[model samples]
Target chain A: MDNNTFHHALKIREDLCIGCSHCMNVCPTEAIRVKNGKSVLIAEKCIDCGECFRVCPVSAIIIDHDDFNRIFDYKYRVALIPSVFTGQFPDEISEKQIHSVMMELGFTHIYEVENGVEILVDAINKYAEQNPVQRPLISSFCPAVIRLIQVKFPSLVDNIIRVKPPLDISAGFIIREFAGSGIPAEEVGIFYVTPCAAKIAAIKDPVGESSSSISGVINMDFLFSKVLRQVKQKKSDTCAIPTSGELTARATCWSLTNGEASQLSGRCLAIDEIHNVIEFLEKIENEELNDIDYLELRACDESCAGGVLTTSNRFLTADRLRNRATNRDKAPVQKHPEGFRDISSEKQFLEDNISIDPIKPRSILMLDENMAEAMKKMDRVNRIMMLLPMVDCGICGAPSCQALAQDIVQNNAKIHQCIFIQKILEQKGEMSLEEGVSVMQDIWGFSKTNKYRDLKGI
Target chain B: MMHFEFPIEGGNFLKAGSASSQLKKILKQLNVDPRIIKRVVVAAYEAEVNVVAHAYRGIIMIDIDTSRICIQLVDEGPGIPDIGRAMQMGFSTASPEVREMGFGAGMGLPNIKSNSDELSITSEVGKGTTVKITNYLEQ
Candidate 1:
């Protein structure tokens, strides 16, 4: 019944969705139900993997970022870095130097997500020992994956290792680490530099997890560029600029292509491309992949590196990261604050949030009549979908043939929206060029987001 | 007047998660709260799905009353030989196909057990399986 509490991290513009069923099709939990005319993203089941936003070429999907000005109201500000970020920079930018950059960025202190990952790994490793020889343990690294499993594969909810994501785990530690710092948790703002929409959505809709400790999110695209510009303009190029071999890069790397999950033991496999991940998760539902010990699935290919709104290119950025991570000697060599206190209670820690709640399902699915009507609509969709190839050519805003079907039922779309279908018809002398142009304009609706668009108006 | 049953086939990847969704729908019509409904549906669905994934074939029985909701999943599929061990968190017999859909977390039984106010399982290896779950109202 809590499915009624479905809250979306991002809202879909019916005008922008283009009836593309990509989001619905790739959602891990099957939480997305295409009803009416547009995509109905079930917030209860959405893992916030940001897969939909990434898959949408129209740049229609977006995660709202926090205004840095809002932090000025706070007495103190801090930046939380994921451990995977340790691999994002050059050797000159040592860990301590990166901390200095926080000072450079008007933040009083900086915390590493790696510290959280280490502690979280310890907790999970402890849990694994108690339940060895059971089912292969799944990594809890991905909050989206964890929640996706929770709502969609509640049957396997127990299978989800009782651990939290690096960010949540780390943020909790920071609070605890700052307990006696003379700064109140409320007075101090700890902003996370997010790589993808999942973390932002996770902040809003946490699953198989605990309350978020993050105060707010700053997209790396926004934060990194400003920091880089500030550093460049400072004329402090040769000052060593407080080098950081940790964070900013390796943490980004950790989120790369399921690298962090590979660190865990079990029948594990990683899936990129939300659709593939969804299909894989479904198999897990049907009792397939039982022997595979660990599954490290990411909605985006190259995992977090392929995050929708990052400033870096997937291939080039990952290559640069590889260079940085190789030089770092791992933690222990990394520096820590001289005097820091944690501000969180053990009861409030992310690790303590593994308990599952059972309630009566208050799902407001299609009423009997609604279902019948939906079924009829679905049949029409099916017929149209069959006529179109499944390639999801994206000639239509919809990613695949099925999305066109969903759009058709919603009445917001038509079968003629598909260019491939039109092309097929044209070859068969069923469509004319003029008709194709009209369908093209109708399929991929134009957005005024020319500011965010690339050369091709993506 | 109000009953729903989905024929669950063993090893059917595409068919998996069907019963859970159906049961969820039925519970929804009962005017259950969204939070409670999600929990019940997810738990009941997990158990039902396990029947299809881990067991051979099974019947999922659910009864919703004014006081409480009860679900009994009886399967002809091979029963769990070690109920104690199987009950542990992260234990699973799911196949690769199930894992692909992210259902082989081995957390199924533990989730069902933890979520429900009352749960009982009786099974015999190679014989069959049965799982009973009761979620009392306001409990």
Candidate 2:
């Protein structure tokens, strides 16, 4: 099996899942179902937002980031680390110490994603000021949010800004510069140190573009222990990479919530958390926020700092980022490094290539294979729903009244399976309880009074 | 054709967009294209908000056939005094409180016109207003 589809970004380990339905209920996209005592993922319906991955109690959901061992295959490996990684450590360990630790981990070079973010911030500010789209241009930084819009609110597809994400921009720069460098093209590898599984999934299957230059993704949590070990070693070595001060304070702030909007000057709204993002996007869809210039939305609660894979407390990480930003006093340069300026600045971020076409909604009820038969099944579902109590009590093993009705129409469940429906059937004056029991036995293939209890073989 | 009717209580900000959300769900169950669902949702939501912001009470009636979905919002309220002015951008009769809450940016009707394939409005100044929006089911 191809690695990309082997288990998807969020994989459910059937042996560990307890079928509590917690993941199914909390999923934003409703992409999970409890069937036969296990949680099954509806692959096509899943946007891989990592909601289920975060809510799973038993750690049964595994992220499919690239194996760390893969780094050895290339002669030269460069790590593109998100700025949030700096805040994951103690403040005493300076930014310079972090890059040295990455270098010690077999990485030939460490390129902080913050640099790319600075250029992106500049690019966005210039684009929004010069060529504004329909009011409230939505930020396309979060891949999960982009996919959600694709599945849930495609009409707003035009609203998403067209710029490539910071990590991808960094990767694209590396790929563009590789030809001039003396190193063989095949020997160089680029890995993104990501805080969320959604980034890993996005690298493999991009929504806005045909492909990504990112070679692989490494979860921040996976590197937490490794970096800690290096910190304990306390070995110091001089590295060629520039420190956080080399980038703008605005770019480093991207690790914290509301960072993206802070870089722009306008009526920009920055919203975090999945639930709030949904509500805010609805307002945008209704044209209620037409006066606003930009909208920054993140899937994680506290933005990247609160990603599922990170071990550090989000609040502590955010405070650390603030402290670091204040300590760095250098101002950002208006011009970017050579070669990177043109690609990051000249391209229209909201152009045709980045605007994704709307996708069909997830199929919640496909009653039958044929359209006519499906219509008949829909009628059957409605009839069954009328007979149901419509309370959405999950006692019948379905999430809602509509789900139970759908199950009945599809022949996967019987109306008598509902306790209320069974009581109604038994209430008929002519039929005795025994007759009702017999009828239930015929339909359900189970005897109310078990003969096994009376066995005398012993 | 199928019909769905939902009552809308004016001044109920808590439940203002429920009807349109329900409409989106129903369209999804019927396997309507997501693009059409979005267009219908935007138009329906604008009409729903108009009813909530300016009317005493209203009813959202959705009629869906094989090829089209029609949303008719009829409300008992102080209707629009000038239809031409209402159709233009940045023209609203909403109260200051509604504007403060971000509901009246004067983009509702114009947004509906942009999202829908066909739209019609009929109003009696002191009696009521009816906004009919139609969107093609297929792309």
The best candidate by TM-score is: 2
List, residue by residue over A174-286, the lDDT tens digit for candidate 2.
65556446656678788888888778778887765666778888989889778877877886655534422255567778856889888787888889988899889877765
Off by over 4 Å in 1: A1-47, A51-60, A84-98, A130-134, A147-155, A235-253, A315-326, A330-458, B1-139
Candidate 2 structure lDDT: 0.74
True contacts kept of 1: 0.07
Cα lDDT of model 1 by residue, A395-415, tens digit? 555545665566566675677
Q: lDDT scores for all predictions?
A: 0.62, 0.74
**TM-score of the second chain, cand. 2:** 0.97
Specify the poorest-scoring 10-residue window by lDDT in model 1 chain A: A359-368
What DockQ values do the models have? 0.08, 0.32
